[model samples]
Target: MLMAKLMNLVSKMPINPLIGAAGVSAVPMAARVANKVGLESNPHNFLLMHAMGPNVAGVIGSAVAAGVMIKYLG
Candidate 1:
């Protein structure tokens, strides 16, 4: 979350830092939580769509990491 906020400060995109929290293995849940938090801060700030990108990316990253671990350990 902090990294996201920091990047946001330097980046040109208007990305909600809360969406950073959505980059977790629990895909939908993380996105939903980000959306909920965003809504809490501003009712009009619906972050679900923004969060989903990172959420899905996280899942894919986790799968790739798991695959690498299995290849090395199995």
Candidate 2:
């Protein structure tokens, strides 16, 4: 959430900062939440697709992180 807000402030993009929250361990749920929040803010702001990118990235990132952790700690 903080990173999202910071990016929004720094980039000045029209993108909803809520999308950033989608980049979490709970991939699909986070994207859904972002979409829900965006819809609540504005009916026209459909952010599901936008949020998916981060959501997918989060999943991949988690996998990679887990691999690294296992490699070093397991």
Candidate 3:
């Protein structure tokens, strides 16, 4: 019971930093996902990335920002 309560509290804590670490850890995994999705074609294959996020917002915002950069500079 005590363990459960501890876990519950941990779950409610801010996990964004952890999530970011998870995303960083997922770099290789993201490449795999991109390959699976065919984003890994030709030159893109070398630069494509796959990642988990520290949080949903972080990942989504990163993606949006990347898109914007690509739109303007890619």
Candidate 4:
């Protein structure tokens, strides 16, 4: 939810700033989300690893999107 909003807000910015913001923001956010899920889930469920997969993917996807956006916008 918040990530979506952040993306939307950053989309209006210039290419370089968008790429930098999204790239830097993703790392700590992914870590925070993974830790939160780990603490909330059952000990045996191993949800942290599962959650991190998508989180990292999202980060990568956003980075790719930023790159694509730069190709056209820059």
Score each candidate by Cα lDDT.
Answer: 0.88, 0.85, 0.46, 0.54
Query: Residue pairs in steric clash, candidate 3?
Result: 19-54, 20-54, 23-52, 30-50, 31-50
> How accurate locally is residue 11 in candidate 4, as Cα lDDT from 0 to 100?
87
Put the candidates in TM-score order, highest first: 1, 2, 4, 3
TM-score of each: 0.87, 0.83, 0.29, 0.45
Any runs in candidate 3 off by more than 4 Å, and if so which? 1-54
What tens-digit string does per-residue lDDT give for candidate 2 at 1-74? 67666676878565567877888878689999999998999999899999999899999999999999999999
Better of 2 and 3 by lDDT: 2
> Which 10-residue window of candidate 1 scores lowest in summed lDDT?
14-23
- TM-score of candidate 3 versus the correct structure, residues matched by position: 0.29
1 or 2, greater by lDDT: 1
Q: Tell me model 1's lDDT, rounded to 2 decimals.
A: 0.88
Q: After superposition, how far is residue 72 of candidate 1 from its true place, in Å?
A: 0.7
Tens digits of lDDT, candidate 1, 2-74: 7767787989996667777898989699999999988988999888999999899999999999999999999
Which of 1 and 4 is ahead in lDDT?
Answer: 1
lDDT of 2 at 24: 88
lDDT for residue 15 in candidate 2, whole number 0-100: 54
Off by over 4 Å in 4: 1-25, 31-41
lDDT of 3 by residue, 1-74 (tens): 35445566779663222223334334455544544444434444332322233334456667888899999997
Decide which is better by lDDT, 3 or 4: 4
Model 4 clash pairs?
Answer: none
